[model samples]
Target: MAALLLIATAALLAFRGAYADKVYPAVAVGDVPVGGLPRDAAETRLAERAAALAAQPLRFAAGDRTWTPTLADLGVSLDLEASLGAAYRVGREATAPDRLWSAANLVRNDRAVPFGLRLDLGVLGRWCDGIDAEFGREPRAAALVVEGATVSIEPEVDGIAVDREAVRAAAVAAVAAPSDGVAPLPIVTTPAAIRAADLAGARARVGAALAAPVAVVHEGRRWELAPEDLGRFVAPIVDPARTGADAVTLDLDQPALAAFLSERFAAEIEREPVDALLGWNEGPVVVEEGVDGRAIQAETFAREVTTAFFAPGGTVPVPVEIVKPAVDGTNLDQLGITTLLARGDSNYDGGSFDRDTNVEVGARLLNGTLVPPGGEFSFNGAIGEITADKGYVVSTVVQGERAGRDIGGGICQVSTTVFRAALLAGLPITEWWPHSYRILTYEHDGWGPGYDASILQPEGDPFGGGDLRFANPSDSWLLVESWTTGVHVVVNIYGPDLGYDAQFSETTFDGPFPHEEADLETVNPALPPGTIEQTEWPLDGSEASFTRDVYGPDGELLESRQFFTKFRGRGNVWQVSPDMVGQSPAGG
Candidate 1:
């Protein structure tokens, strides 16, 4: 026994010395045997094995779906030095007797050393996120639905999500044992935040709000909203104050409600304010009182209706806004119209019935017109369009150098009167056009030839018409009062009396030229053949001009302006038959 013990001791010392810088015999790293190999050689062998494993595809299975990805693609690699060191330390790290026993046992049965793996958790997590996005289902919260007068709740749904950590751990295990490269995916279920029980209160509130029809009253008018219509204005919203199942509330869509109210009641509740009409009796007098306008307060009324919708009664008073007129009866004194500044009169006696009717209609339209301070007064704008619909009659009118019959023929009588009033008032005449020829009606009542004003509305163009316009240079509103007596039409201007005296110089005449011979005759299809009827007598042409000097109340001249009038002469207008058309008179 003594001799056998000495031989065993020698063998043990040899074994320890042989493996001092190498792995023990029968030790392996992931099936790659590194036993009795030096540290560098063992590391090289392990690295070669790891490279082969990394190149191989790893299978990941979730249900029937599977993904085959290489270990290197998953950012996984073997720590070669750490694995080799572990393999080398196995038999040498224990007590002497145990170390000897382990070394002897390792020779008979190979021992596997767990691979020290380097895993990129970031990569693994991102890969798992992609899988989750592809196959995961998100939970749906409960909500309220309104259809007509009926209300109900939609149930919540539960969802499934992949367990990313479990997936990562499984991948690591599969990479370590390349022979079994398949990993099973783990899944978890998620519960929704709000369930059907949470929206019960909201559903009930919405149902009650739409249970009955509501009425909105303003003055004597009443508008009704049916239960079905009310449903469109109410909706369910998430309540931030609560959590879990009790976090939902029903609220009214105020804007939608306001729009609904406007559509139903706008025409009846809204109106424009009427300004007070002023007339001169002895001084400035309010002939008619002004009326305040009415408008619907849509938003305010909507809120009130929302509150009333849940109240005991279904009747709610509509909120209204009263709009005051700019010129009211009590504010006449503020208008600064203290006296009559000027009065212009024209004689329309012995005229035809159509001419008399047109002059009366024109004067009535001009009555009670107001010109704001420093604002231009447009005669065409004031009287609007001279149409037959506005009570104008067909009468004689001047077109270019010829007198013809058309609608609104005698309307110039009114424009001429307004021009005389504005001129006498010392107002600035911005636009003025004289008649194409002299008219005895304008030269009536001692007014000379240069005092006429003409206005015409061009066909097919509203703004292209001729207009007599003037500017009020005062600090007060000017009112025009026009009326007609039995034979004479009168127009008067009322405003703050700016003390001004207007002086007119003697009128000068230039020529009495005759009309072109071509214009002497015109073809008339309505007249009989070989017949000639003189429609108008010939009138000689003349140029008339006069200067006016406006003086202030203190005798200081304020303005000096010259007014010029060119009257084109016309030969006799004769309506001849087609056979006699273009024929000159016998004398010529």
Candidate 2:
């Protein structure tokens, strides 16, 4: 009995081992086969075999953070009954087109399993779900690799209909290279060889893109490149080592700078000194002068201008100045020359004078007029020319029909004072005349003296009467002060007040004495007949007198003198005609 039991036990163990081996085919990590067997049955056997070996735990991979399954872990099984049934009728009966049986037959007879089985080794991986191999590494990947490191690419192909051999070959290549660990591949550096084409392109770009000459500005000067100069274009390449910078500065073209500066900054005009403008009193000469018209030692007019605009170190674009003339004048006659106080006597030698009794008579008809130095004085023309429209009370004027006529009578006083003042000043006399007969009050001791009255002919007078005139010879202005109250006429002269006093006395000569009336005739006499309203005794060819004196500022007499003037006898006249002499005196 024991002998029989041992035989059966051995046989059973042997059968089980064989069955396990048959279902599990040898396969690499990545391999595929097309199906000839029933897919479900083939898959079942693969699972069964994989499960039977799964009892042994998977090996640990280096650098793996987790565990992975091996081929034996997934149990696999096969469908024997269907496989056999299909294989027997293969190529023998007219088969339904199924390659399963035909492929099984080949496996059985040729010992080549044409049947395909797919293994589902649930998340199959060497370790940590990654392929455990290496490839394409430098320095022979093995040099740097650790024993258990896996450094290879992993593929994810599933449910593929491919020949098993191709799958095996691909899987071998995928895991073939030795491990190189996690170190990055060393970079192979090699200087790029310069190609002829590359060199030519670089030269072309550099030549075309070079710049024109730079314009340098320094210290208010411009250094320019000469026209058509090739220096900027063909300048020698500076050695970067020597200069430490890319560009070289040609010392600003000094010759060129000097030439340009000469043109722009050259002085163009001479300068003048002083304002060429001077006052009119300074006269026509433009230059400065001494007290006696001598040229003063000073800068020329042009030099003054230069100092004003282009002095040393002056900036360019200097501004120019223009000159103008000046105006000037002064009053000089205002010193103290009284009207009638002349320094000496003045007289008109032999001349008959007419006289009027009216004090309101015009100075032109009463006496004379005066003007101070540089003084411009006017009269009568302003007081109305004899029209009676000027408030002038007409007085007597003798004539044939109008024995006593009235005319511009009393304007004489104004003219008289002016004449005396001008005379005393030694001013040059311009115009003068005398009255026809003697009138008192203008007479000295019953004798008319130095009396010359002007009957200002419309064309002759400058003042209310004929004027006495003068001008300021010095560089000063003349001021005449004139004032007249009802009884007196006053005039004063002021100026640089030339510190000198002057006075005057008058000397006059009378001509012709009076004669008695011999014959009498009447023809409507304008005056009452035989009536005499005597103003003065008519002298009949008698003597007249003249006196002279000089005075100081206080009106004190400096000198006094007397002289006699003889007047010619009056001519005979008759009031009757020759025809009337023959007729009776009263009743003839």
> lDDT for each of the candidates?
0.81, 0.33
Stretches of candidate 2 exceeding 4 Å from the true structure = 1-384, 397-404, 444-448, 458-486, 491-537, 540-588
Residue pair clashes in candidate 1: 198-245
Q: Candidate 1: which stretches are off by over 4 Å? A: 1-216, 223-267, 298-318, 384-391, 398-407, 457-464, 513-517, 520-542, 553-557, 566-588
Count clashing residue pairs in model 1: 1
Q: Which ten residues in a row have the lowest lDDT in candidate 2?
A: 140-149
Can you write out model 1's per-residue Cα lDDT over 1-588, one digit (the tens) per residue? 998999988987888898889888889887788888988998889889888877877676777888776777676778887888789888886688788788778868989888888888787677767777888789887777778988888899877777866766665777655545556657777877778888887777778877888887867777778878877777556665666756665567898999988778888778888777789877678888889998889999888888877662668888889999878887888888888989988887667888889989999988988888888999888888878899987888742337478888788888899999988888788999998787777777888878878888887664477899988888898999998998788899999989989888988878888765344666767777888777778788889998888999899999999999988777777777888765647222
lDDT of 1 at 117: 86
